[model samples]
Target: MTVENASAPPSTRRPSAERAAALAIQHLLSRQDAQGWWKGDLECNVTSDAEDLLLRQFLDIQDKKTTHAAARYIRGQQREDATWATFHGGPGELSTTIEAYVALRLAGDAPDDPHMAGAAAWIRAHGGIAASRVFTRIWLALFGWWKWDDLPELPPEVIFLPKWFPLDIYHFACWARQIIVPLTIVSAKRPVRPAPFSLNELHTDPRLPNPSRRLAPVNSWDGFFQRLDKALHAYHKVAPRRLRKAAMSRAALWIIERLESDGCWGGIQPQATYSLIALRVLGYQLEHPVMRAGLASLDTFAVWREDGARMIEIAQSPVWDTSLAVCALADAGVNPDHPALVKATDWMLGKQILRRGDWAVRRPGLDPGGWAFEFHNNNNPDLDDTAEVILALRRVQHPDPVRVSAAIRRGVRWSLGMQSGNGAWGAFDVDNNSSLPGKLPFCDFAEVTDPPSADVTAHVVEMLANEGRSADPRTQRGIEWLLTEQEPSGAWFGRWGVNHVYGTGAVVPALIAAGLPAAHPAIRRAVTWLRSVQNDDGGWGEDPRSYLDEDWVGRGTSTASQTAWALLALLAADERESEAVERGIGWITLAQREDGTWDEPHFTGTSFPGDMSLSYHLYRQVFPLMALGRYLRAVQQGQSVCGTSDLPR
Candidate 1:
């Protein structure tokens, strides 16, 4: 590994990094929408596509075109072992395989078809439908393939719980809360559409469906929740008819009030699907206006490919993508007032969510001015997007200076006010670190609550420093929290991106931007840990398995986004000329495709660490450009790399 000579003459540094960044900038520009937003395809698992087919089947609206297209996409995702994994190259997941199998059956594939038969054998060996997650069982119940009574109880009366209660709606994270509220209505109705065919072949034993599993120890939290679920089940039987009716009505109102303007709930697919089914259970016909609008909203989540496959995005990410794109272009030496940058800024400014959303429940006095990840979600603007958007706005010399300034100020105040009790920040809510939501049997699939994470806090700290608030007491506390959270191995746990690489990448720059010297003990330790993990290919990669198994930390096949993350950290720690940085940069440049983009099929983004993962299409382009642009600037400066203050304003 050879390090670049930082003291060499101006044009003698790594020119490939510069060349690759230039080509990447043009590629990204061409992909931008006419409306001035950039959202790459958000690719997740086959469950989104499978659940989509299930929903259409339940509503008697499953058309041949959509069914065949979705089936093609699902078939393409099947692993060599004949099952679907939640992420690329990960192990086969039982529930995912189950959902995919049922969906193919609906597409007219016979059970004995080679693919279908192989999937059923895998499912049975893996404990079959009985061992799948609670949500999958509920989907089966809708088609009368599983008994609803055997599932955990989520009564409509749960809507009546006080906000101060342990399992109240607010205790769940915003995403889970949106789905749960509507699901309570579904659970109460227990309405089942006739089955198109039996799913007996997918079960471990056709005679004894939903075999009972052993209970947890009595004193444990899981045991307590198990008993509580039993109690709720009993209560469901003897409850007064009038009270249940009123409770269901109240829950219906709650779902209706929270539906986004685009007719989706919180700009996610699963939530919208459940909300529609819940309303249909309450007597809303397919021809009703709300149902019509919602069915149309679901259509937008579908991405029809050139090869005639239909894919489903779990959610869209326009605000997140556009903000990062602007920051990358600015770092690559685009003029601050370039029409592309200005147009993106104008579009971002228009997206400032001023109306108070669910986040205001805990922060009633804080003003509402933040950005959401999706195009139309107004009720759940998160701290991560708001901070990144502010950082992006600071890089651009927009035409409406006053407008940008006000938006920045509001964003800063709201972010500061959102700090959790422990002096950190979660993505959507304040101090939403509930312990009970996780123990509930029904929430066994994925994360049910939002909690403070190192990546989110790092972004906030970086944003505050750029806004000249580095010395503010709030920012100082955030810095302290980050230092304390660092692992003995010198990495932070990434709750959003792939494991340790992402967390270290995000934290190193934030700490430096907040005035920590390159020699700071924490910064040096992080740099050392990153250097140790450099892959044999001169890049960095951490598998999604790192979230589950300890040995997989900072280990996996190299990917473009993860490599850029590592490079960003090294460059921020004043190691631009180090061998690790040089080699990492070389790997990224050499890996570039002819189109100025890199092909990364791995899941680098996270929704629920081990259970759900994401492949943000724009991540491959934006992050590498940011890393290379900073390297180019460091070469030009002959010393320190370009920090936020050095960028054009």
Candidate 2:
């Protein structure tokens, strides 16, 4: 399968290292959670074999029934060339294919099995064992399929660098830093053992590249970063023993302190699993509290199938899911007085954290009032949750005024404080605009560090404006930032949601809330862009490519969620009478599933751009409800809307 790469150039010129260093320090200072651990999302290709192996090793559930069920599911994903992809319809990934092949082997599939043979051939054809990433090679080395010397050096001594250094520990993204901290200890110790079988058949070359060899020249900036990595490796040897030991001990304690009750580190799947194994090799016993809890947390990550087999999800998202549901239901006109609404609000109120979390470091002195994305992820409280929760509480008429008011004050204050000097806000981080982290040669993904985005900032602005605080300086600056961030074509770049449609939908409403007149130039420009992009089916849809490619604008078959997003934008701009709104509403009504949900496969939310996408299942219901409710309200008020006659069938 062919996949297009749509990585955009850095929108601005590269920052000087001095400037970047200062920014990194500033960003780091803002991200310190009250609990004293830095946290952020750990993104990886979810189809990796690490997860499959984790399920078997931790749960001891490699029964034949479970094995065959999982085998069938994995085999079904094999591409025409007999390999697997990290993403749907994308090129075969070497690490993913290797891991999948190994996973099947662990499930008792013989190397000679037709499916296994096919996967082996694909691996050999692609540079086989030699072409896989360092992380993949290290995993193999752990089991002795590969040699320790074949992996890049990730010495513990690197952690000793002062904070001001260009490649200091703090320079890496929070996720990378967390994993690397523990990994440094594991690497310095360099422990290796044997796997059950040899991967000799998997390689076209019997020998792997020397880890010390320079593979590519330091030509471009990315190339320069790779050389910097090599220099760090050189420095690894001959480092002072005292400093090395101190850094390792500090890093180890750093990792240990963040371990959640459930044996997982930071309650994220990758860190918890990898760190558990790493700590075990460092002599932590299986029965130890940290290890046992980490192992048990693996169960929380598993989802049982009808076949009695299980697939491990990277992490659960109930808090994020629930918040979106509440907003959707509220927008759909579910009265705040409804029993379900009341129940949800009460539960949400209970969940509101009254004390500061790790975010307090980045947002020093702010009152502790925000929500997290997971029921238990206290280390990573998010702005998205805070905004949604505020909206939900505002709709609840019977909420205890004292508690609700206090929560609102804390949340608003925290959010305002979290805004970057640029006048926008990131989701889980603040002023996380350091460019050096993304320039690291070890990084290949887009958005290595979180920076404020149009969608998230817009949501926060709208939430604050709805609270009757639109006139505040912070809110006004946020509005100015949104106006400035808009593309020349009038569209806004969506960082957390899909492409322009999501960004436009969110920013338009926020602009209106910030007191921009309906006829404001920015609002008009955004409305025209939405109208121009509406699909032929009387709805709106944008492919994920929009995140990667500017040229893929206006692409994808119309879907219910995108259509609803479009309708909401037009409604916010008082363009409900337009043909685009008519068609958008028509698409939503026509596509409604029998259960009152809409069926669409495209993911509507983005995490790390170009790497992961999320299908917010409730987006269809909530957005349409919101759009339809507003449209109906306009009609009742006798507004001269463009397409009132074309309500969905």
Candidate 3:
């Protein structure tokens, strides 16, 4: 589909690189509002669309228009083998396949249809109803397709667990905690609605006692958890009714407390859906203010594609996108007092979360001045976003310098205080390094813990250095951590993006920004890695497979955004006059479309690495502009290709 882009300037007879860079910068500026903000589609996969339909079916509010639209979107994503994948050109994911099948069935697709039959065969061959993730099975259990007793037990009493206790609700990752708290209520209620048709045909060997394979090693953590699960199940039946009721009430209160923004609970669809479901089971009516608001909020996430509608985005990225846009513009030499920057700055300033959130557990007294990725994710002001926002604001000379400094100071203190004891930073929460939950029987998806990551640590360090804190002990330790994390091949593992390319791209610049010399072994290793990964097309790309396997690290079809990342990394590492950097710049100059933007259908940005991949549509435009701008500026100034001339040292 053709998308409108930022308007570029008149194409003059300048160098190809300069012309393309100017065009891209102009186009990006054109896309900004008078208020100085930018937002692009936060596209996920069909699972969201399918889940939306399932939620509608469970509520008995399935509308024909939305169903047909959503079904069309799901159908378009099914592979020839009757399965769906989490990312483009990736292997079929069993959970995605199961969810798509259920959504299609809910949309009135007959199980005997050719596509339906093929999917059924595939599902049964794999493991049928029981082989899916714990979350998937829970969804099926809601429709009477699976037995509640067969699912993992999430008692409402989980909310009562002390914060210090392992496996407590609070101890899980922030997103997981929000999901689990509401789930405890659902699991306790055990409410099952009648399905339009039985999924007997989808089960493997229906004659077997339990067609769903719930396998865990007999003598390990799984066994221990299994035994504990049995004990909990037994306790469920004999427990005092009053206590359970009180726990359910407590869970309901917790869910309602997080109903942020208009009607959203934590600005995520999954949590909102579960919150709605649990509240309904708790006897909230359809017209309840909370329910209506939640249902209305879901509409914001729906995008009507040419094929049909897709419930793709978990949440929007207004703050993240806006800050990145501002930084790119500033890098292009846009006036700091430009109305666009001023308006966007004011808008971003309003979004800083001042109230305490779950992060308060780790730093009980730290003031809240961090920004969330999404507009309404107030309780979870992430470290990455906070650092980026501070960097962006620092670029513009806002009229209210005092306010900006105050906000930046609070954000810095909050981000630094949130750092893990190992001298690195996670996107959200502190020292959230729990690996035990990932080993649970139902957690077949990728790591769910919010652990410290190279990309995040780099951002934090870069922010501190830009603010003239390069020699700060925390900043130095972060740089050291990054050095130790580098792979022997010179690439670092990307925790939030696709793979090594993203990791190296992030770490190199941050290291240089913190006054690490380019000749340093760590910096040279990373620079060597970036050069080695360059493709014949003069661009770079890392396959999504890199998230799952090491062999594919820094290997994939040449992509515009990945190329920009590699170029930026090289430039920051003093590779300005290098042929590799020039070739990369040439590739970017050649790839720019007539509209001044570049095409990147490939999923680049990631959520949970392997579990869920994302495409920040703006990446193709934003990074290239920043990279090209920095390159031209450095060349014209006759200086080294280091980032921002004001070196901290």
- TM-scores, all models, native as reference: 0.98, 0.84, 0.95
Residues 259-283, model 3: lDDT tens digits: 8867887778888888889999999
Consecutive 10-residue window with the lowest summed lDDT within model 3: 1-10
Per-model RMSD to reference: 2.4, 10.8, 3.5
What TM-score, to 2 decimals, does candidate 1 have? 0.98
Can you write out model 2's per-residue Cα lDDT over 1-649, one digit (the tens) per residue? 1111211122211122123223322333343343322222222343533455734543343457656666666776678887876544446777788878877777778999888898899888887777776667767777677776555566776667786676666556556676777778877767665467778878886664332455565577766766766676676677778887787777777778777655666556767766775677677877888778877776676656675545555555555555555555454445656655566666777767776655565666777778876656656677877887787677666456687778788888878878889888888767667887666644544456777889888889888888777899998999999999999988998887778888998889878866777899998999889988877667777777776688767567676667777877788788765666655655555565444545665566676666666555445545665566666555456563222112211
Error of 2 at 245 (Å): 3.2
Superposition TM-score, candidate 2 onto the true structure:
0.84
Candidate number of the best lDDT: 1
Model 2 vs truth, CA RMSD: 10.8
